[model samples]
Target: MESLPEETSSSSSTTTSGGGVGCGGAGEKLPIRPPIQPPSEKYSPLDWSAYFDQESDVFIPESENVFHVYTAGKEGPVVFCLHGGGYSGLSFALAARKIKQEARIVAMDLRGHGKSSTENDLDLSIERLCGDVLAVIKTMHGDSPPAILLVGHSMGGAVAVHVAAKKVLPSLAGLIVVDVVEGTAMASLMHMQKLLSNRMQYFPSIEKAIEWSVKGGTLRNIDSARISIPSTVKYDDSKKCYVHRARLMETEQYWRGWYEGLSEKFLSSPVPKILLLAGTDRLDRALTIGQMQGKFQMVLVRHTGHAIQEDVPDEFAITVLNFISRNRIGPNGVEIPGLRRPMQSQQ
Candidate 1:
């Protein structure tokens, strides 16, 4: 129900919250995702908007999903980043800039969220969601120097995992998945996404509405157990209501088949990788940091939730950087940590 921005060439497209074309039927063009580069001689502007330009697109030949890409560290390999729920590629601006300033980090807002436009096509399937990321890989075909590192948080983290499973990414040095617990089963997550969406629905007119969100905080019943995040709010005096900076459909689509067989997908990844998760969110921390199984390494961060990257950017960035710096199968493989039960394992 939101208006679509004017369409552009796959590489020229800008960011959007919903329907944007990608390599798949999603519409945006996609390029093969390259690897991270070394540091640059000088720093590029780290400020979100200033650092990013609507430059060359990474399009997928199959679908039209376009990820508005901004590059940094023209010197090193590439780091392909996927953002969390409702956040655009800009969410990584601060941390990406601070982390090894010269590294070329590419951040993208996946479909139905951030700057991607999901107007023409509706792909609520996890496979389709991953196709958007695939668009980036197909475009690069291997121009990178160092290696490609995939980092994703929450939904984006899921996308990173889906792609890492495929052997196509040989340059994939490592993977970093934030705040997600695998094997919980998709149906349970779908229900939770629905409950949260129902709670955050915006009113037709904020002026006539009893409550509205603000920059520092959101309007809500103090007693409500639900959690919230901080965001910049804009109130149009003419309209007499508050408009959230995030896209509406993004809020609604969180559970729309986000995990269509995701468990199976993780088990199917081509290589074992690293996982970073939150200790707070019951869902994220449900499983203990398991033993590293030569294929997978897991780390735990306390005091965070589903959106750990935004809640604590510096720590999140460091965790991911650390993983990429050490992308390898240890002699002992991965040492799975002890579990904090009622948590389950992949048996």
Candidate 2:
């Protein structure tokens, strides 16, 4: 569901002590790397204390995407923003725009999604995509540790977990996971595969492409009568047919590996957090098959859907604010029972 991120040329990197998690190849097995010391102090801790002041504004973006990367808020702590599938940093623009009034916000267009690239050639693996996020943060830090917050939704949420677990992100003030779970890596892979198989056939023109895309997909559920076209999707006039502005194919690969799984060592690392689920989620626990073992807090978004931001942004925003107020750090947060729909909800 995401747009494409511009393809980045990777720097040569060999596993080092505390080199963070190993980047697994597509359909390739990854070897474990030993944990290393934090990066240089320049990148060690982010100074979040200053951003709390009101009157933050958007600065020029630091990325090279089709859309501008929004950096807003005052001089204080920084927060990196990650959006859900098929969307871009624009998805968080509205909410984070407000948060900017109090702190700095750096919202990223996930690689291959949202203005990064134009191909729907998606790779839905967790490991690579998660690495993309960390790479961006590292680029921003330039070898400095500054305190910051991460607001990740759905797929973005899973990426957040894997990054935070690495403990390589210095001065991460807090983590806010929006409606994501451990098994998400697996679920996203299946979802993306079906989506790609069904709608990936490209059209000669943009109009025809978007037309066909609209006929299928979660887009049909938009209830056009009430829902506005999400910012994530926009018609590309230059092309006669609609083309996903995001890179669909590479994204697919990132999530594919994710579902296969990331290192278990990270599950315990992301603490001081919150989880927002939708009351409407109907995933079957039995079919999920695996057991959810660990600790984390969970809250249902009253009457929301899988895309909490799109379905009920207000509630989602409120819950996030509450989590920020109640637990910025310290206790990490609560681990709710694994998400599973009851027989009744299914009916």
Candidate 3:
């Protein structure tokens, strides 16, 4: 895999290339471009690389998959973040910045996503994905096992449930699943299939690609799209164009049985879990608060869509930090002092 560009400080100004009506000089102002909408905030210099550290590579033996991992903070309980389908580890850039101060944040691109290798033709099953996650947890812990908190979104949430069900991580602490529920997953999957079916496979310029990404989906936050699009697309020197890092067809294949029987596995697991939903309207009426009362905590993030972390990152980070800090589980299967589950609400 090609090495990512070196990291730059948050104060640095990064220029956009590919000149056109929408593209301009470093300080030039332009009209809002369709598809790739300009960010809501005042246009300042933007640099996506400043959000996280340089990427580190990891190879998972169980899945025979090589992953691109991005980490922050040097010490604290391990917090592993898994991104949703068609998204990379960089999707957690904003959340990582906030959570790293409290915990060791480790986010990775799952097999066939981001800079990770998809050439192995490995089965993208939930079991294999869970194994990949377990490998990373063990590798991070080294000789002695340490408590780990797993946070996942969308398809990633399903993967986290499988991992929790396996109960392989003796030091596993808790779980936070974002914007995905077993009851609503099939509908979400159908929507994703329709969207990917019509998505552009290749673009002649990076600006066009970015524009397409911003306007294509339910994403309302242009700033988040700007940060996310760059990492998801790469310039192909051979083809003289930019293409998605992961093929749309391959991503769709993985969704075949992604949510089947996940709710049962998630609720039955003994691990402490939190289900963070983006919108209550999209939630399955069948899965009520009563059912999840003791099994898992459910919180609703209002006014946001599927990408809860991106749309409302500060709240997302704070919620996770509060959840982890309050519900900390020690290695001896005992709750740490000052740890208590936060009251759930539909805020």
Top of the candidates by lDDT? 3
Put the candidates in lDDT order, highest first: 3, 1, 2
Quick one: best TM-score, which candidate? Answer: 3
Return the TM-score for candidate 3, rounded to 2 decimals: 0.76
TM-score of each: 0.60, 0.58, 0.76
Model 3 C-alpha lDDT per residue in residues 199-284, reported as the tens digit of each score: 78888866666656656653545567667766777889998998887665665666756788777877776767788986676456
- Evaluate all candidate structures by whole-model CA lDDT and list the values in order: 0.51, 0.51, 0.71
In angstroms, what RMSD does candidate 2 have relative to the true structure?
23.6
RMSD (Cα, Å) of candidate 3?
Answer: 10.9
Give the residue spans of candidate 1 off by over 4 A. Answer: 1-47, 50-65, 100-102, 118-121, 140-146, 184-187, 203-257, 260-264, 267-272, 280-295, 328-347
Q: Which of 1 and 3 is ahead in TM-score? A: 3
Candidate 2's C-alpha runs over 4 A off are 1-68, 117-127, 184-188, 197-239, 247-253, 262-266, 280-294, 328-347
* lDDT by residue (tens digit), candidate 1, 85-199: 5555655655565554535677775665544554433454566767667666657543322366778876777778777665455456557777665554353554665654665
Model 3, runs deviating above 4 Å: 1-49, 61-64, 118-122, 188-192, 237-239, 251-253, 289-292, 329-347
Q: Candidate 1's C-alpha lDDT?
A: 0.51
